[model samples]
Target: MKMDGETEQLHVVLFPFMAHGHMIPTLDMARLFAARGVKTTLITTPLNAPTFTTAIQKGKNTSRPPLINIQVFRFPAQEAGLPQGCENLEQALGPGVMDQFFKASAMLKEQLEQFLDKTRPDCLMAGMIFTWATDSASKFNIPRLVFHGTCYFSLCVGEILRLHQPYKNVSSDQEPVNTFLLPSLPHQIHMTRLQLSEELWSNKETDYKKRSSKVKESELESFGVIVNSFYELEPDYADFFKKDLGRRAWHIGPVSLYNRSNQEKAQRGKTSSIDQHECLKWLNSKKPDSVIYICFGSTIHLIPSQIHQVLMALEATGQEFIWVVRNEDDLGGFEQKMTGKGLIIRGWAPQMLILEHEAIGAFVTHCGWNSTLEGIAAGLPMVTWPMFAEQFYNEKLVTDILKIGIPVGAKKWTTVPSIEDVIKQNAIEKALREIMEGDAAEERRCRSKEFKNMAWKALEEGGSSYSDLSALIHELRGLSTKNHN
Candidate 1:
């Protein structure tokens, strides 16, 4: 791709799904691309753009001029019968209105195609949920890569379970009663039917199943997958995804590490409810490795009963902690009771900053990939309490393979969790003690520290992730050259 006797720069377009979890990493990935001198454009909705503004501006000032661009398309919230500002999944997928969010997402396809036609980018990296993107990229002969927003372990586990149907042999969905091993993986991963989604086990074809099938098909048809993991993080599963599955894939993360500064870390995803300095000051007041940081990510809000149980557990353990909650209405002045002992962030917390703090020793997490990786990067052992989605799969990676986490014994899976899904105070306290107390806790911390070192090395100049990013950019340039000729 030579222009005026010099090689033309590659232009890459990133289209992330409108969820905080999905968009955050994709935004980091955009910065990674731009840092490598690739012209990058991030396609997002108007409302979603604000979440990314700070990070994007930081990239522009840090990097060469015009390295990144923002392309916006109007979200059809009204047509989808959603609230006017309901552009993101956090707002749109409420209760029975999930279909409306999907409908609105589908409406953006035509606009995206128009942008593709105008920009004619060399590569398109889109979120996995946007199945129609494969065809859109094909129309313009651009290379399309799917970003699944998870580790290779989960994907391998998911694909094998989907293909093998080993759960069928079980007579019941009970946890230990009908536990099964995922066959032919790098490790002997155990699972129960209760941990998996109903769509995976059920024979009935539902809307969710149909959508998943389309997404899987699109993944296979795309150029490759861009994973938010590094090779050292999950070597066996990474090998399995590429060699065994024969899928084209690249691992170029701990993407959260892209934010090298404290300011960037504080402003990574959304505005923090508590001031960054205030959070740091409180953490500094605690002794080293004394505070447990608890958060369930943006999507999963605990029910009142579940919240009460967690509070009871935290209180009973007498552990100093920082808990990020969706609402404080359920608290009923519990914050006052634990004034010096606890900090309850009402909305978003500066997770990356909090994780890296020296005073923080353990994490009580929902096992979301983003939080999981952040915890691993910070060398903090976790109390894994998986609620839904691929969180259970990630919990297995943490507890079984890594041996750096203690599961809180969450059994059921549901989007709208009920009383049955609530883990009692006793269970929560037990797991917390397991990760924060004995000689076993020290061993987990040692292992977690080793991973933290590996994560750092993976992003260095000649390291796995750095090399992978360079290789991807080189490949995209090759494609551009081929097309130009």
Candidate 2:
């Protein structure tokens, strides 16, 4: 396949951040580009490569000429003072080796620059974390598009908070219950001071603040932003991101929709611990919209005491549920106690497949963008329990703007939450009851289903996301022609 005026096919390079949530969507984006007849190359390290191999092979088997290519780079783990196989954030987070992880990631800059100088692709699409990628692409005269791995609503909210500084007027930064209204957003979203990162409140020039400043600076200098969402999901925020923020951006997602078959859905990011057939059989036994699907995503893990609270909540509600836990040992006979009522997936579960199942009713999510979009795609109302990062912003999108989720009252932004801050069994049970029963629950479900239908429509021919993708390809082709000439 060739462009209208060009003899060569347009080639684009994708570099995703080494996190499960980021990598999954980037792979989907690669396939989306490949399906449109564009040549795509995905750049990852050795440890992370295995996670993507199956998906790449599946893409090759289906697509003609196998447009998707995988390029592996050596992760400088040892050089950066990290353990030998620590290539991803999940691994690094567990040992509190984040500084080393960032150092290792920074070490990839020279290699990436050399690769771009050699290949000189038409465009470079990279994760937002790779702040150096902007200058690297600029060095090769290639347009760089930053992928935030999130939706426009969260981005808009973040930007509004940054510029307006609404939290500055709040009484005290230490007060977990102090609520502040986010100024100048489309919605009147209120957030607690505790839900925000400490860096936002402090005047200290820490490493995180410095890195964030660079990321924002790079975004300003980059060609455009790529969002993993559909316009219909948040029309106001989508428009606000472009018109008000004045940034060149594209929404060619619910990229998860690219997985057209059960096989693809079942094996999306990481290989599932449980068999797809068995998982499906369990879901089939339950009635429609009866089970609450619970997962906190790949990064966050609840402590044993917190896990116990969740288990007690599940038992108290007597709700049929599927909970994905980091370790089965944390369950400690609770799994046996809830035997028929709960399905405890020890490691990775086929999230998309389970979410798409008819019996899966409500979602208890961390409000990670990937999980948020997946829940939206599956038409399931959520119980949002944001842990860290921009998740609180996403929770606002769900509970405030979209009104398809009920917040589980998780106030503090923490990576390793203590028992003191654990969202209690009562709060979890309350959120479950609210989302799974009553008139309000039905309304939320209806709204969620509407977004789900819109998500599907956005991927169909001539739809919003579809047209945006086509337009992006066309724009890239034009740039490619100009670059060659």
- TM per candidate comes to 0.97, 0.97
Candidate 2 lDDT trough over 10 residues, lowest sum: 1-10
Candidate 1 whole-model C-alpha lDDT, 0 to 1: 0.90
The parts of candidate 2 lying over 4 Å away from their true place are: 5-8, 63-65, 94-96, 173-177
- Scored against the true structure, residue 235 in model 2 reaches a CA lDDT of 94
- Give each model's clash number: 0, 0
Off by over 4 Å in 1: 1-8, 60-66
Taken over the whole model, the C-alpha lDDT of each candidate is 0.90, 0.90
Superposed Cα deviation of residue 117, candidate 1 (Å): 0.9
Alpha-carbon deviation at 196 in model 1, angstroms: 1.2
User: Residue 142 lDDT in model 1?
Assistant: 94
Candidate 2 displacement at residue 294 in angstroms: 0.5
